[model samples]
Target: GKKVIIIGAGIAGLAASIRLSIKGFQVDVFEANSYPGGKLTEIIMDGYRFDAGPSLFTLPEQIDELFALAGLKTEDFFRYKRLEVNCNYFWEDGARLSAYSDLDKFTKEVAYQFGEQPENIKKALDKSAYIYKYLAPLFMHRSLHKWSTWLNKKAMASYFRIGKFGLFHTMNQANQRQFKHPKLAQLFNRYATYNGSNPYQTPATLNIIPHLEFNKGAYFPTEGMHSITSSLYTLAKQLGVNFHFNKAVDKILVKDKVAIGIQAGGKSYDGNYILNNMDMVTAYKTLLNEEKQPTRLLKQPKSSSALIFYWGVKKVFPELDLHNILFSKDYAKEFKAIFKDKDIDDDPTVYINITSVQKANDAPEGAMNWFTMINVPNDQGQDWEYLKAKARKAIIRKINATLHTDIEPLIEVEQILDPIGIATKTSSANGALYGNSSNNRYAAFLRHPNYSSKIKNLYFCGGSVHPGGGIPLCLLSAKIVADMIPKP
Candidate 1:
């Protein structure tokens, strides 16, 4: 078997290394940062811990499969519990909604809160399930470029059922058709942001997101979200996978259009295959500079980025749940500012996630660890400092008004993550959270492929490439990359 070199120690890289090692291939992962996990990381501030990125966890089966492949028991290393209450929502009109994990309970709640019929909710879920059934095999489980995939009977069936996938209209339109109440429509439309997209413009195929959460059930990692990274890293190391930390890969050596190795820390590490788990944009621009880049795909519009504030609160709110969203009155205007105007909305909807509720060790006995986030436009030469300060004040005011608590005074510690910070830390271009925006119908096909068409032995994984971002899809991206590698 040939030696494999992987760039970046993110979840995708770790997963690839584990899979390759189990297949009897020698795997060496080169990570620029001292720690692994990239965005799936943790930050400890004065004893309060926060999973710096991706608070919500869904699809535990995908993670368990990785452990099983490594010949390890999933329970022995990692564990998670399904969330009973997925999230709590607050509206501007003094209305509140507790999104329960139980489907019947949630449907009844929606019906009770808004005068919408439960049958309408059931119909929407049925449609979403149909979309998932057709698209999963074609778009998710296999590579679209592969000949075998296209030739398969399942692929042919998917091709015929493409109309049901809603390739023509936007997600907002689809939701509006499903629910008569504007609030209910807005509630479903919010799922589009799970991947950092605008529902009004993004394809209705995105409606499948809610089915992933409410149907499959959302989860909370027992030790916290960062435990996911820690457990995977441990499993990878235990499987005889080597990791070179703080070693930035400077270039991907190409000989006769074939990748031979990678150059990092003034030395060459040769390998039969190269998996780039770094951002696709940075991987090509920095590592494979001599190769011709995918200009059209690279130039495609990016999804919205987030401006986050990690606060160590001195007091805990009993009214707040593990996940909470404070919706803005004008949802259309808010998205318009992000997608069309390319700026932060004046009244941006705020999402506050408190991990201390689930894991008491995350904060002191009387305090809470708050992960506050708001969607914003990707970096396009905006004045971030000014916008961040202004947004912070507005968020404080909004929370105070809605919760009836002056939250500003209880902030014991404060840290921020903006678009610039996101880009610098994760190597993502324009700090796009989930790669290119799904605003257009062609975005699914327009995304950069896991394997390079131009450069042999060079491959891509992680959020920026196929399968797209978020924890579940990022794991799927790694699976696609690993499957593409030649067997020993």
Candidate 2:
């Protein structure tokens, strides 16, 4: 069998390994960390287990497709149930909304809470579906950098329809124009942060995000988010893929415009093809140091990072669901604090995801694991110690005000993950969560391609490359790369 060396055993890398191994390739995956899953790993605090990264689970069909390709039952490896209640939204003024998976119920709930016209809510959801329908096949499922993608009649048709389906407006502008109440607009505008983009600057095309959660339905794994990694790792191993942990790759061994293999742990392992699934910026700065860098793509504005507080709360509120959003009063100011001022807003929008609600074993009896997070600027030499301390207070204040409970005392155990910590741990440049921000409508076309332009037999896959971030997109990136490499 032909050999393929996969770098960084992230979600994309794991997916790529599975696909290539099925295609009759000897897949050898090398990971820097002792365990796989990249940012999709988990943490434990005082008997409470929290998914360290990528809490929200959507588009599980992407994972199912891999197992299907292997002719294996996905349920045997991994399983997830669609959430009936997608998320619970809370405002400071005592306005609460339960976004349901059922469109009729959600429309009625929104109408009851915000007095928004049910027809308007449905229309807004239809618009999101419209955008996702035309864009997914062309921009998301395929490689944007390839000429064949633009030349194909079907993809070209979809590409041209973007002007019609995806309105030329910022997420904030589109929501403001679509809804009468600012609260409803703010609720929809929060979708931009799904990819770590500023709603005020990111193109309104991002509004399609709601379609996934509401229309397709949000889901939670039977175990926890970490099970996503564990299951995939197990599947990859079953397919005869090799994994070497704690062997951080030193460099990509390239020769005469061809990727030969990689140097890791002071030794070199040659392969027929090399696939880099690490962040593009760090890969260029370190792995491909000798090669000419794609400066423009690397210089593009990075997506916002996150400040996560893994708090093991001693008390559980039956009112709070698996997903909860405590919105900021000044939504625009909160975004400005992240993208412009490069600081956390005093009243930042806080997202609290509790897996314990779904899997009781995640925490102690009557307790919950709070994966509390707030979007923040990526690393820029700022004082993270000060910011983390300040943000912690702001978060506590926001939670107390919205939940009507002094949560500071409920904390039995606490652990923090800042941008600096994320950067150091994951080797992600600036700790940008989703690689490049889709701030502009053209951001999709600006992302690095799935394969290296200068180096032959060199491929790229991951959130940092094409098709963007999140679990689904990362899985798609791997499919794109695996498709690009010809089977022996």
Candidate 3:
């Protein structure tokens, strides 16, 4: 069997390791951190647990498939429930909307609160579902860069239906055309941010994002989001995938434009196949320093980063669920600050994820663990200290005004994760949550491919590569990378 080496033990790395090992390849994974999961990891402070990154959970089938591949039941190793109430949205004007997982309930709620026609909401959802059905088969399931993908009947059919995707217009324009109410349009437009994209600039095809949560349904693991990592890691270990934590890969040793091994700890460990789970830009500049790099892909606009405040509150709010969104009054202005001005918005949209709402021991009795976050531009040598300070104040003000509570006083324990910290921790270029913004219509195709074009026997996976970021996409990247590899 050919030996394969995976750099970084992120979700994609772990999944790739498992997939390759199952395919009869000897797999070894090297992670710079002491633990696995990358951005999907966890943090615990003062008995309050928080998922360090990616709070939302969708696409349970992707996680389950890994266990099934190992001849095990998903429930035995990992378990999750579909969230009945996916998220509760709040506006500055005291208007509230609960996005019920049930389509009928969600339509009724939207109609009652925003005075929009129920059928209009339903029609929009139906369109979103339609777009996803076409796009997922074309864009997600396979690599766009490969000629084999384009020759398919399904992809050709999807290409013909491209006009229905509204690729010419921005997401905001599409939403505005669908809904008469500003709030409803804003709600739909926010879906662009799911991929770290600007709604005003990104193609309306991204409207497919809402369908994932609303039609397919949002979910939560029984233990916590981090369990997704821990369980997969456990399975990988059981499948004989070797992991070397706290081992930073210094160089990807190449010969004849082919990946042969990695240099780490001043030693060389050779392999037949090498898969990089690190951010593609960092991988090129650092590991593949001597190799011909893909400059155009490396130079794509980095996606928005985040400023997170993990607070252990002494009190609980029953009105809040697993996910709550406190939207900015001026959505367009907020994006401008992120993409154009390269800073946080004065009125940034705040997302609060309370895992303790489902996991009882995540916080002390009568206390809640609030993972509060706001989107900001990625790291660019900015004064993060000043920005974080200003953001804290602004976030506190927003939360207080929307929730009708002095949230600052309820903080019994606290920790913060800023862009600088995220970049340092995850090795994500510029601390971008997603590798690149999908602001441009071609972003989906512009992402770095799963396999390197210039380097043979070298592959890439994770949020930084093909198919974009988020748990599901990262997992899909692993599958695509695995599919690209020859059988052992």
lDDT of 3 by residue, 53-120 (tens): 98889889998899999899999999999999999999878999999998889888988998899888
- Candidate 1 on 208-316: residue-level lDDT in tens? 8888888888999999999999999999999999999999999999999899999998999899999999988888889988889898988888888999999999997
Off by over 4 Å in 1: none
Q: Report the poorest 10 consecutive residues by lDDT, candidate 2.
A: 158-167
Alpha-carbon runs more than 4 Å astray in model 2: none
* TM-score (all chains, Cα) for each model: 0.99, 0.99, 0.99
Residue pairs of candidate 3 with colliding backbone atoms: none
Tens digits of lDDT, candidate 2, 1-488: 78999999999999999999999999999999999999999998679999999989999998899999999999998999999999999999999999998889988998898899998888888999988888888888889888888787777677677675655878888888899999999999999999989999988889889999888889999999899999989999999999999999999999999999999989999999999998989999999999999999989999999999999999989989999999999999998899999998999899999999999999999899999999999998889999999999999999999989999989999999999888887888899999999998889988999998899999999999999988889999999999989987
True-structure Cα RMSD, model 3:
0.8
lDDT assessment of candidate 3: 0.92
Per-residue error for 81 in candidate 3, Å, reads: 0.2
TM-score of 1: 0.99
